[model samples]
Target: MLLTLAKEIGFSHAAAVDPSSLKAQQEVRELCAADRCGHYGRNWSCPPYAGELTAAQKQLARCTEGVLVQTTGNLADEFDIEGIGRLMQLHSRRFATLARQARLLYPKVLPLSAGPCTVCRHCTCPTRPCRFPQKRLSSMEAFGLMVGDVCRAAGLPYSDGSKTMTFTSCILIMQ
Candidate 1:
């Protein structure tokens, strides 16, 4: 039922994961803190702004289960920036929709998305508080959760194969 619901909401793949065994790796957060993605200090959903890695760990500690969702896209080539961007956008949209649905079923659900929150074209961080605090999403890496490790722990494949790119996000559910 859950997997079907996830698919209907637009996720290409979905799986139940053990939240208790998930790890928040410091190295992942370190990469963000280094501003490698160019969104670390520029967005409200990234580190130093999203909240400390420890805080994310504490928040997920209360989650009893997790639903990992993925959207995979095929690129013409590894350097296909347009394809990559389009796929990421699609994944973000689907993840957000799935998060809203999960929130209805599990009120305390925390959604960790594939990238920075794109709910607004321009984030008002540093200048002002988040406009959609309720809908804002933190990236998996920002939360210090390594995508490959989480997927393996969930018995899901992180990569689909060559010429394919997969974006992963998770909804932490209390129930």
Candidate 2:
């Protein structure tokens, strides 16, 4: 029922992952510390501002179940930056829509996306309050989650193969 609802809401793939199955790694936190994704300190949904790793872990602990969602798009090439950005944007929109729908069905949910919140071209983080706190989605990485490991634990593929870009997001549902 969850997977079907997810797909109907536009997720290409969805699976239930037990929250207890998630294992947070300091190594993943290190990647954020490195600013490899480049949005580290620039966005409200990313690192430093997203809160401590322990806090993220605690948030996840409150949820008993989650749905891993993926939207995979075929890239023209590895250097298709434009294609990649477009795909990510598309995936984010779909994820946000699904999240809102899920929120209606579920009493409480925490939606984590593949990247920082793009609800606005310029985020008003640190300087001002989030304009859409209710809609703002946090990044999975910022939540101290290793997307690949989480996918594996959920019996899902992190990658559909090379030349294909996959954006992953998860909705932690409290029941």
Candidate 3:
């Protein structure tokens, strides 16, 4: 039912995953520390503020399973920047809806997004408290998760091997 809802909400794909398969590795955290996306220490959903790696692992241990959701878009060329931006926006909105509904069904739902929280135009992170704490959804990277590894474990392809861009997110459920 949740998977169907995910599709209805506009995700390209959705699948179930075993919680045990999602591991929190220092290597992944190290990558996040690189701050390629530039949200590393700037947003509450990013690392440091996202919580310690141990805390993320502990939360993962409590989850029974998860649902991996993705939104994929074909690029016109190697530099289809506009297309990528559109897909990102669409995926973010869709994932937020899915996460919100999932929380309604299971209060303990943990939503790990593909990127930083987009609830605010500019996060009041390090400067002040998050204006919308209840709406902020942390990224999987923020939780020290390697999105590729999690997708592979879920029997889903992180990328379709096409000239496309894919954004992925997952909702962990405790039962």
Give the Cα error of residue 105 in candidate 2, in Å: 1.6
Candidate lDDT (C-alpha), each: 0.84, 0.85, 0.87
Q: Sort the predicted structures by TM-score, highest score first.
A: 3, 1, 2
Q: In model 1, what lDDT does residue 157 have?
A: 91
Cα lDDT of model 3 by residue, 1-175, tens digit: 6787787897999999888887888887788889888888899988778888898889999998789999998999768999999999999989989988988888788989988999888998899999988878989888888899989988888997767999999998875
Candidate 2 Cα lDDT to native: 0.85
C-alpha TM-score for every candidate: 0.94, 0.92, 0.95
Error of 2 at 65 (Å): 1.4
Where model 2 places Cα greater than 4 Å from the true spot, the runs are none
**Model 1 worst lDDT window (10 residues):** 1-10
lDDT of 3: 0.87
The collision pairs in model 2 are: none
Better of 1 and 2 by TM-score: 1
- Cα lDDT tens digits for candidate 2, 60-88: 88887888999888999999999999889
- List clash counts for every candidate, in order: 0, 0, 0
Better of 2 and 3 by TM-score: 3
